[model samples]
Target: MIRARAIIDRDALAHNLSRVRALAPHSRVYAAVKADGYGHGAVTVAGALAAADGFAVSSLDEALQLRWAGIDKPVAMLSQQLDATVCEQAGEYGLEPVVFHETQIEALERYVGPALKIWVKLDSGMHRLGFAPDRVDAIVTRLAALERIEINGWLTHLACADDPSRPETQAQLDVFAQVTAGRPGLRSIANSAGVLGWPAAHADVVRPGIMLYGSSPMSDRDASSYDLKPAMHLSAPLIARNPIAAGETIGYGATWRTPEAMDIGVIGIGYGDGYPRHAPSGTPVLIDGVRVPLVGRVSMDMITVDLRNAPNAKVGDRATLWGGGLDPDEVARHADTIAYELFCRLTPRVRFEVI
Candidate 1:
């Protein structure tokens, strides 16, 4: 048996995708499977998310993972550096590369490969990757000159759609609309946040990232608010249960002290397995559905949790780290991070199981 593992729930994975559809009913869904399905195991979830119109990945290699796994749906490469060689491979594999910079467009214009499918990205205020909105005219005109290139869609990323009240999202959407007016191919802007918050940003396609993996794209709300199920259940076995006296310090730095004489369960998980080392005392865990507060400093391979909530928890009971009953977003908040980091940073030492 695996000491610690992330159980990928296929039904929940599909349910999350359905949630995206529910939110963006008219748009084609490009389920973001980047960062190895946000660390839920890409290929496995890709196979399960087959209902998605397509899959979005961060790099060319990630796109290949889906293709190699026999996923024939359109795979969009969101951040792969486009070059002559990269363009050729993209053409061969039918991958759509998001060409944001002028140099990338130059690479596509110069490529004599069979044909390439690509998405033209507009900066739209994120100012991260896409071409500036002012350049959209020249971008559209220049791209019109390339016979070998096909615009799979005109897409942009939202910087603050998570906060629906943020004016920047509306301004960005306005800029996107003004720039791409009367243009041809599909238009996409809604990430998971936009999909949930700004229905107007859902153009011809909506590429949802975190929500598909069962994490909230918004801070104030949770996945359950949208009826999204947790797709990844992370847990580990309780390796030891010991009695501790009041004032007994636990783990490194003696950061946590027992408030009273009680039993503490040592779970087989830690930062080494992607359970946040920064998770302070009072972070919650679950044993047999009983909520247990995490105590002490997390080590590379172990963490101690106060078992007051689960007096029946034993040495072999599996402790739920952030799924099933407990929300990953809640755990992420206690760790002073977001669920995305928790999902993406999980080390390979932790076993992954697909259900």
Candidate 2:
């Protein structure tokens, strides 16, 4: 068997969801399982977070997958672009469609079925796929007579809640409140960032995504802030250790030349396994709780890390590429990206072990 594997901790997932619950005590947490639980495996993460108020998926297909896997929680697709056949399937599978645009509303109205649960999306500020805040009343009035369509409530996405001090957060909340004022239905506006940093944004339903996977959506927060544990530990066993002389190039393009003689261990994971190819040297990795620096260019199937600080590191020594001691956020920062990309980019080449 290959030594490289992804370890998924269900306990960690539960812990993180609990933190979201605490943060938005009065709101229902819609666990975002989109992008396959942001790469932790959707069905697995959804099942693990079954205690959540509900689940959120990206498409009707994802919702169907969850249903096929026997997850019966209410799943709201963040985007709804389904055809008549797909919309019927959604009704049959008990998936909620997020109606954002007038066109989607028209489609759903045309496909009118008995089991369709609708969640209207209001464009408070993101300016993405959602009804304009000012048009909420007219849209609601139009849909109120559609007996087949179950208008459950409202949902909005936050743009800058990740920046805790941004005034835009309050502006969005005010707009959302104005649109949803005294509505006798469910109201939702919080994402992971909104749940953690913007208290006013937390309405009847809070959608927590990145945080449920043990990542802080807000740059101002970290894993420790909310008592959350990382659900994924991407690791590989050291394949070999080679000593290089000073002034010799280490990897492709010779991007990093050794300043002195050093012993480095090769790990059996690379871009093929979803590690970033552009990850520069000095990216922090963890081996037995000790920090190691990645050296040289990452290849399709291998990477070399300086083990001088971890002299005892040897072949078969565990290399935590991310998670545990090393935060995936830091790696994302080094790659000029976010944890969402880092997680979803992990290919199926690596084995996944759920704990």
Query: Which tens-of-lDDT digit does each residue in 117-201 have in candidate 1?
Result: 8899989899899998777888888888999988878999999999977899999989999988888889999999999999999
Alpha-carbon runs more than 4 Å astray in model 1: none
Worst 10 residues of 2 by lDDT: 106-115
**CA RMSD of all predictions:** 1.1, 1.3
lDDT of 2 at 78: 85
For lDDT, the strongest prediction is 1
**Whole-model lDDT for model 1 versus the true structure?**
0.90
Q: What is the lDDT of residue 34 in candidate 2?
A: 94
- Model 2 residue 297 lDDT? 94
Ten contiguous residues minimizing lDDT sum, candidate 1: 132-141
- Over 232-278, each residue of candidate 2 has an lDDT whose tens digit, in order, gives 99999899999989889888998888889988789999999999999
